[model samples]
Target: MSYAANFERMGRGFDLAHAIAEADRCLLCHDAPCSKGCPAETDPGAFIRKLRFKNITGAIRTIKTNNILGGACGVLCPTPRLCEKECSARFQSLARPQGADRPIQIGKIQRFLIEHSWEQGSEVFDKPEPRPAKIAVVGSGPAGLSCAAELARDGYQVTVFEARPEPGGVLRYGVVSYRFDLQFLRREMEDIQALGVNFQCNSAIQGKESAERLLKNGYGAVFLAPGLWAAATLKPTPEDIEGLFSSVVYLAALRDGRLAEMARRIQGRTVAVIGGGSVAMDCIESAVKLGARDVYLIYRRSYRQMPAEPDERIEAQEAGVHFLLLNQPVDYVTTDHNRLQGVKLVRTRLGEPDDSGRRRPEPIAGSTWVLEADVVIEAIGNRAPEESPEWYPHVKVNGQKLIQADPASGKTSAAGIFAGGDIVRGPALVVQAVQDGKVAARAIKAYLDQ
Candidate 1:
């Protein structure tokens, strides 16, 4: 059986009738809280209102005006945490004992309009004539792509330099295919391309000299969005042993079609994945699809505190993946051949709130234990690349090692250079990165106009 065939999209988009019904559910509040909750500030209320009135083209244009990657945002964004969570109907339903009112399916409706326009061969966005000033965008993730699109629309010549063979960055490589199809991403990229933004694939900008060369070559500005490329390790055992792998590397390999070689080596073996975020869930699902006999999702936090969406966790559970909560891996129990064995873990408990507002997990002193594991995948987190400071000597960074820039403008320490997305804010949602790119584009445009 083809593993790709078995993996399905997370949700089917809404049809026209259902999309209008969901749009009608919106109260059309004067000050839409759902729009406020949206990081990309797509103005969900206005679009839904237009959609309700059967103005499909206008609704899509409104959405694209704020979020260049509106289609991908519809599928990838955590709606429950953002727009839906702040819906007035959701609050109203909560206030009333039996109100039965729910937040409008804003994401589904947006997806419907965007996908519908694409299917009908209608215009989804308006383009402007090219200007004289040129802008160079490094990276092809949401941030780089969004920034490039915005700049291109303003008539500024925009060229996105991507390190990978293909663009889309995380949308193509980091995310699991089941969450969103490659065709969906391809369509979104085509929209950006249609806006006159040029994509230079297989072009990696390594250091300050690379950026300086762009400036020397008449590019007025540069936006660095090289995302968090370094994966957090399980100290002292981060090496690529016969069975050890980082979730980031593993997922990228799976996306690049290279995981099959490694997957076949561990067929029917038990796999233990460590983390509590959506990426961990992806790892679990991918391992299952790769024919792993048993998959265990180990997290140091409780279920309620998991960073992943509840629906995602539910899907994993339904797929027969085991959830091992409140467990922290301390050591790798390797075989004498140093090939593969298991992992040693310690029980943990939630403590006082940490800087992130969630309760910190404390490892119990005597709660160490070993679990069976043919392979161990660490999905803890990712870090900024170590060569960043050296790569951009002029830019400043915070103690956390993230780029230091104004949140409002995405302005960096150096003049004519801006930064955003994972490189600046650390690993975050795609919508947030899209907003960063939009903000940075405006700032760059303002600087150029001055």
Candidate 2:
């Protein structure tokens, strides 16, 4: 089935009347905990109040003031766990001696207002007097885009560089289309671009040469926001099998309209995805959407311990994907010279908590079993590329990977060089990346003034 068909089956978009009604349900609490809970500090209660008052433009303005990527976040942020989770209404309900009502559907209402404003061609930026400095943002993902937009609004000349032919980075390539449509992302990018932020597509900052070139090209400050691009290694020989793939590669293909190629290779077959993160859930859902008859998500931990967002896991389950919890793939079972027939997996049990405070998976002896499948997709995690530190050794970094920057300012060790997003925090939520970019933009502005 086509992507549109899948969305139709999944109920694409939200109901406008329902959203407005939900917005009216907000208690509009004082010092709203929802806003405080947001890493980006998006004032959910205030925006919802604006929506309730029919001040759509004001709501959009409030959101864009703090988060340029608010359009995307309105649709993609895990509000159930962040904003809505901390809603005072839920607390009030609990205190009522009986269940009163669910928390205000803040996320859906925010998405409705933002999407409606964009559809109505409402202006996204407030006019500002021109400033002196110019800043260059590498990677046009949430971080780069947010930085560029904020800097542009602050009257600074901002230019964004994206190695990929298109902007939006992982939002376009890594995120599943079912959850976030490309058209919405493109609209948001266009809105930011209209604010005088220039974007140079298919431009890569590979090494020191590129970084130096950007600096010499009249850019006052350079912000490196290149996200994690290297997928973590999977042990054993299964990764070398013809049908085995990484979630990054798999999702990129789907995003780039190469799903037909993937479909032809694994259509009408059973597929196995190893990992418990959101990426793994995306892989499983994508496989099913691409015509995999039986898709299994095998993870080494229990459902509670799975790194994936609970809603994502539930969505995957609703999409007919199977979960093999507490199981780790040991090796691939090969039948022919080039085809992967299945995976040899061992059941696992939770052991002592690891450094991250999550119980580690330990292999259960003699619990090995073979799960038949034609394709295997690994979705463990990803790391930042090595070229970043090599190009700018002065840039602070926690390890060879992970750009190290001030939590408040997003400033690196090098003067006039800032970093954020996945490059700094490793893989993280889109909203957090937006927060990083906004923080970096403010810091860049302050530094340039000096």
TM-scores of the models, in the given order?
Answer: 0.94, 0.94
Worst 10 residues of 1 by lDDT: 2-11
Which lDDT tens digits does candidate 1 get at residues 1-450? 676565534457898888988888888888889999999999898899898788888998898888988999998888999998888888787667785878888888888888987898777656687689999999999999999999998889999999899999889889887777788888888889988999899998887557656777899999989888788888754674778888878888877877667578557999999998888998998899888999999999899999888999999999999999999988888778787688899999999999989999999999999998998888999888777676667789887679898989999998888999998988898999999999999999999999
- Once superposed on the true structure, which residue ranges of model 2 sit more than 4 Å away at CA? 1-4, 7-11, 95-100, 236-240
The per-residue C-alpha lDDT of model 2 at residue 450 equals: 88
lDDT against true structure, model 1: 0.87
Provide the lDDT at 135 for model 2: 89
TM-score of candidate 2 versus the correct structure, residues matched by position:
0.94
The digit string of per-residue lDDT tens for model 2 on 1-450 reads 574366322234556788778877888788888888788877887888887888878888878777777767877888888888888888777667676677777777767777787778887666788887888999988999888888998788888889999999899888877778777787778878788888889988887657646767888999999998877757644356788898888889878878668888667999999998888888988888878889999999899988888888988899888899999888888866867888899999999999989999999999999999989998988888756677676776776478889989998888788888998988799999999998998899888988
Clashing pairs in model 1, backbone N/Cα/C closer than 3 A: 131-155
